[model samples]
Target: MAGRIIQVYGLWVWVAFAFFIFVLFNQSHSPLPHSSGKPSTVKERMMRAEKAWETSVTLRHEMANKHPGYPRIPLFPAQTLEAFGKYPYTIWDFFPPVYTCPHDIQRVGRLGDGGKWVCGMSLYENRPALPASKAGKRTKPGTVIYSFGVNGDSSFEAEMLARVPSAEIFAYDYTVASLGPQIAGPDSSRAYFKQVQLDRMDVLDRTPPFMSLQTLMKNNSHTYIDILKIDIEGAEYYSFDSFMDWCDRENAGEMPIGQIMIELHLTDDENLNFNRLLKWWERLEKFGMRPTWLEVNLLAVTLNPNKADPRCVEYVLVNHKDRKNIMRQES
Candidate 1:
């Protein structure tokens, strides 16, 4: 009955809420709270936090209007809010692991160090199923992949090429001169490497040149990236602002990114400024980047004994907004 009502209303929250009121009307006892009328301290705090978020959203719109282009920067809340107890206690508490994947997922790369998970494999498997005798060959029409912070570990990139023969990969790592041994796959020719670090700013003065995502895409003549993988230590904290800025603009072309496989590193700085972290996470969701899968990097926990929470986490996010287009194109 509830399902039928939800389908009819086309808005589950409001429909469910109406059902709740209807059920409460027939109750023997009144649903209203009793006269012990003191306001809830926690509730008051929650309300204030919600108001602050609303104000922040308005400010974000203003910022977007002020700067309408590809390199959109993220704005963080004032530090004064942190001085008061405005943010939540922990990151996990705020971000519950409840994001559900719309399709199946697969793990790519090495088992231990340099691996990550990717979503929407049904579309990725561009070729039809092969017989037992010819199982090795799986050719795809070609998908665009951008990887940041290779760190000489091309296991993931190599594996992705192996799975999708025609896939084109653009890997960046200013620190490393070249890719690892595993990157030398059968179709390794499709993979391109650049000695450039992914940075918030595109500054040529840097040793290897620190370029932003927008600049990188423009340079490569790539309007859309099929898969964007980032494992740049903790640089991801600021790297996404330009991407999100592009999403904010109506003039900017469609963001048909299929998936994002990122390794999030939670350093002491992020832990201290929890609100900023929270805002960053929320902004990703706002841009239709939905977290589908996550795994805590136990290696980080083992290494950082002083930190109570695991510092590194691997996440496989699917872009819900551009998902349909991916399916249609691949189909």
Candidate 2:
């Protein structure tokens, strides 16, 4: 009887322990956290992760601000603001790395001075003098002044030239294939127009063929150009190269030009583009010219404020000696 009772108690204890273990296992394996039907902890986790990321970004920006030689915020020139206000572009997008100078003032000259103005022809009337009178000849009213790439329409070039009565204009454009009749007609005498390709590189190599500024100077027997305006669809790169080469030759006592007006195109990547621009500026400096005017454009679309177009600004360089003359005149 005692043995049977002990056996029965052992069986009961085993049954109770098994029941307890089963309950504990079920609690441990419950699907409350991961079930699709359960309340979402996932969204809460994601929100927390985003908050952490933003905090990290803020901390990094603060650290960068404290760091030496970090990129500084850029300023705009007064003329640029007046001409093109808050146009969605950042100067950081187009400016080259080494040319990272302040843009808030006239980089080429002091403000409120009668400096040689460059860009859209609004300020040309305020200049101290027009091109000097041609040597030995009495200044004639409305003498022919030939400009390239005017496309048969009167532009700032034509308007500014008109201010000087000694200029009868002849503007040329070869790229506009449809305007041959308008440019080459008998009715085009006061400002004769020609639809001729003025951007060809091969034409520069010819001796007396066509459209060589050197040849034109040779033909006219004139030493200096009064107002040579150039805005030839990024052709300024090669043209300026040639112009510098000519200047070098002139420094060696060969052909030389008087005044030059060129529109410079800069690249978009600040580091790469700035390096390239610095090389060009260094060359200009070697030839004794400095930046007199600069216009930076930030191409932005209405739908996207954060994004900007890459090709966005024009810089104007003039002779440093001329800049000094401007300063003297202003004083």
Q: What digit string (tens of lDDT, one per residue) describes model 1 on residues 57-166?
A: 56544544443331222222223556224422233433433445444567788898888777756566664333222644334335788999888788988888888744
Q: Would you list the C-alpha lDDT of every candidate in the order shown? A: 0.68, 0.43
lDDT string for model 2 (80-184, tens) is 655345333333322222211112122221222112234223223344332445663334322334455554344444344444334444455555533223333
Model 2: weakest 10-residue lDDT segment is 98-107
How do all models score by TM-score? 0.65, 0.45
- On lDDT, the leading prediction is 1
Model 2 clashing residue pairs (backbone)? 89-298, 96-274, 143-168, 174-196
